[model samples]
Target: MSLLDQQSVFSAMLQAGPFAVGDTPPLAHPFSRETKAWVQHIHGNQLLKTKYRSVRNQIFDLLGIATYDEVLALIHDKELRTKAAERAYLLLGNMFGIEGTGQEVIRHLHEYARTADDVISSLRAKVLAPYSAHIETTNEIVTTWDPVELLLALFDDRYHKKARFEAKRKLALMGLAGSIDQRERETKIGEKFLTFLNFLNAFVWSPDCKIGELDIRYLYSTHNRENFSCSAVKVLSEEEARLIIPAVGEKLTLVKRRRFRDNGADIPIYVTIRKKEPSAKVLKLLRKNEKNPATAVDDELGLMAVLNSVNDVKRFVRHLTRSAARAESFMTLEDISDTLTGGEYRGTATGSSGKTSMLKFFARTGGMRIEFILHTNRSYLNYIYQRDVAHDEYEVKRIFDTGVIEFLFPPDIYHLDLQKIRDHQLAWFRRRIEEN
Candidate 1:
């Protein structure tokens, strides 16, 4: 029978008498003559099964089967009831559209059958048949990668050796002979020892980045914008100063105080010039996993420009791009401005505030790559707050989620007050949501 006709039969059965104790409390009123006939038809056909007393079972009973085992047996048996069994299989497959049973049946069919076209082949074909065009369109725009494959590559012996060689070469090129020798010595000790040494080196030695013959004084140079003055600047070296000055100047006009004030109010722009320092974990990641260690670590000699508003962000990017092209300093652009932050609390603060832009680009001059990050005021504030105040709390929570803290620390460590941190995050989230 069609599914609609079968549903009509079940509805009629429910309207009939002998309602089970827990099977949806009985109606307050008496059944009408029409309802009585429906009940009679259901009971007369032995549609009710006391053992399997669920609405699910009632539907299955309508298909002439008592249990899933019976259905499986029929599908597998080929001698006595070959034709009858095929018909039964077809009926069960048709019932896959009935919500809960559909998923269970698909999973079971996949598990039992060797070939794809066994029991529910027709159902699969019909259901997915309409989405071919949509799938094809999406395939053109999306880039897919396999995390499992990347993880496996990390452990491959040849891959590990290549990564190590690249790491040593980078250090040598940067004129860090001691760090290179240290890595070589560790390699001779043992694989585990080499890994430990590499981990230590990542934390101990910062990248030696020198910009050759590039005047970057403009980065640290003070400039006045109406009532706001962005004079807070630092220059590490002459070469760094040379490189940073020009890079910052390119986008400096767009982020000026006057342009920002035109939108609403003037905001301060904080610029910093310094050598990029990779964290121990980041260093280890590059040394052990990255195929091209050079590209993996950008921002060696970095310049960060923090300003207010989304408009300033757009103008900054355009100016930076134009400036880089004009000076022939632009190498590559890693525009992760559109990428959302990770974690359960992600999209809570930055995502909802429309302040999630983070643009990174590499500008090369004489074997030195200078990275720049442009941030909106809200994002900059959020980043500072999280990094300074909530970092420990977030890290602890992450470790707890991974179940590693229990193995490493005492139980009391887990009892640290996380409620306040969670509340703070929630408040930010709610505020951003409301604004959006």
Candidate 2:
């Protein structure tokens, strides 16, 4: 065959997504006609058939057709004909490259594509198999959403009022909601939140395991009981906690400080650690939000890296991502640098100037999920100010919203001057931003 003809065959194969065993090859609709013509031209020539007998046989098997005439008859079934033509194109292309019989192409297909039964069985063994062990105790198999399930729930409720409320809250926190139309604003927020959820999911489920087994206790020291005052805390071995904290913290701090120095900042880098999610927040998340307690409560153990400059923040994030990729302990997810802003709670200004970047990752062992919030010194200072100043009002609003104080305080009391408090925080943020 001419080089042009050979290129045409190879191009057609490339257009197909991937080859699978015992299934029709998926072909690009546009190339169907040319592919059919090429097959017919080769099939009709006895000399070509003799030289490419293996290719011809494989084509016949792929299309379930016995002869060249049978292949032509496939024109009546557009889908079948397209698939047959693609198979022929792939087979001929393989033969041309390897100068081998069509068996090579068949072998390659078998290697890459699993049969339907094989795929189903493999999935059952790898995925459903874990749950199978708990089948005897089905009643005891406390249901929990994996990251994928939580994501699906969010998508399903994309148009719901609650999701819209959540989206608006997200935008309000970012300080970009006022500039856009309500619908458009909600859509942007929804997209961003979905992206955030996706990153969270990946960070929680990398290496692909069931989510419920993730133990947060592995991330902190057992001596750090004070951090768990807010959550359903578990105290694991002090030795395990000690090993994890220093090993992970050292790497994270080293990266942050080195990056800060590299960015020409002579400031000290500060690292803050949280042992577990506060018990109250975990209950609220599980009951009010209907989130899977396993992956949903990711901040159960958290780390924050406070740096001296925004450039240092970016550098630290890059270094941490690279480090996670190299380390066996964790896998980094999509970075949330762009979405980082001030507080998400009620008291802080909707447009708080507390700027920070967030990176999330999944622990390879014990299914622990960890987050690192990167912040410049100024942003960190702003965060502290907003958090402290807003603490009282924030707690009051939370209590009212959760109905913890509904019996004591009337509903009208819930209408506090949240924006005023926010304005104060925003001023602080503004000053810090300006100073930086």
Candidate 3:
């Protein structure tokens, strides 16, 4: 059966009952061999075995296998079992957003298998459809823009086309991002991080985010129309575009400043509350074994403070610290503000030099851990628009360099050698930077 058909079968098995019967019983199905091998692989690996134990019952129940020993007993042919194990890891990893090979791949898959459905349900609830009230705008000032427009700014700015096709192609290559399985996996892994960001959004607008007589203002974004409409993706501000242009690679170069429009609401500094994008979250999980979909929730909620001056950025942090202390609700804090304090400049991807600058930390408050990223106007500009140090460029580099693009988008399926495309994009992004 095709992967989609396999997914349908598993989904059906999970949803309905009366699992095994007839000539093609659950155990007799073609998938049974691969699953049996998967069980063996998990049993053989110590780290994966521990994770398997936690969700052992769920796995057996979902797969319609009565018990662990029952599945193992059927694993007869050693060579066949070994090959099946490899195939199982690769296909299942692609479907479920698990990364890497061997023990770690099985570990991520097992850890999240139990909760995939729940994550899907939660995401559906949040994504309001058919033009409901925009609740995200009621509390804070929200500026909305079409994601297609952002893409247009890059790829089809002069042409005014290709955004939809490019977006669709990218999504398909990225494991059909809109698929039920991928959505559930991404949401489950990034749940805590997203929750923490929601908490921060609430806190920012609350009276608590104040400095004595002065109240802080935060500008955020949300879908301005029906969830499935063209307006699903919002607009990026001039400052936001800096990070986005490089982050988005070469296709999204439609930076028409004159066309950029929003409600004429002014705030001293615009605070962008970003819930880490789902694709980025998946890449992060694949990047390391130490993080799982559930327990690892730090760095999910990113708060980017774009200030007018370095002095303003410093002042904002000082006030933020005081406000958190005043509430007496903070659990722990890491004041990693080397740039603001004139301490050792330890910034950049490698942490060797101080070139890539930003003041960042994790704070536990409102029962959620959030990463606060503070950047001065000048620094923020450089971070996004700079030739070698653009955030968008870094995103492009990691997606290709880590082999994630290839892993998720296999040649047989995508029919595109993404490494060459990666090189092309990196070069195109560079040219765009140099030109304007």
Q: Which ten contiguous residues of candidate 2 have the minimum total lDDT?
A: 13-22
Tens digits of per-residue lDDT for model 2, 116-144 = 12322332353223323321211211121
Top candidate on lDDT is: 3
Q: Give a tens-digit lDDT track for model 3, residues 27-83.
A: 334367755755664465565455445444544433334554444433444554455
Query: By TM-score, how accurate is candidate 3?
Result: 0.44
Ranking according to lDDT, highest score first:
3, 2, 1
Question: Which runs in model 3 stand beyond 4 Å of their true positions?
Answer: 1-61, 65-267, 277-279, 289-291, 294-297, 330-332, 335-337, 340-354, 412-415, 434-436
Better of 1 and 3 by TM-score: 3
So what's the TM-score on candidate 2?
A: 0.29
**Candidate 1: residue pairs that collide:** 214-242, 215-242, 216-241, 216-242, 216-245
Off by over 4 Å in 2: 1-267, 281-283, 286-292, 335-367, 387-395, 402-404, 407-436
lDDT of 1 by residue, 1-436 (tens): 2111322322222212243211112222246664464366457455443322564364344335555334344334545234543444455445432124545544433322212111112212322223223212112112111111121222223333333222222221222222222332333323433332332223211223122212232224332233122334342344554455323212122222212222333334445555432232232222222223243344335666665556666665555455445444443555344331322222321113222335545544323445666665444434333322233233333333322222111123223333443345445533332231
Error at 123, model 1, angstroms: 57
Worst 10 residues of 3 by lDDT: 135-144
Instruction: Please provide TM-scores, in order, for all candidate models, with all chains considered together.
Output: 0.27, 0.29, 0.44
lDDT (C-alpha, whole model) for all candidates: 0.34, 0.35, 0.42
TM-score of 1: 0.27
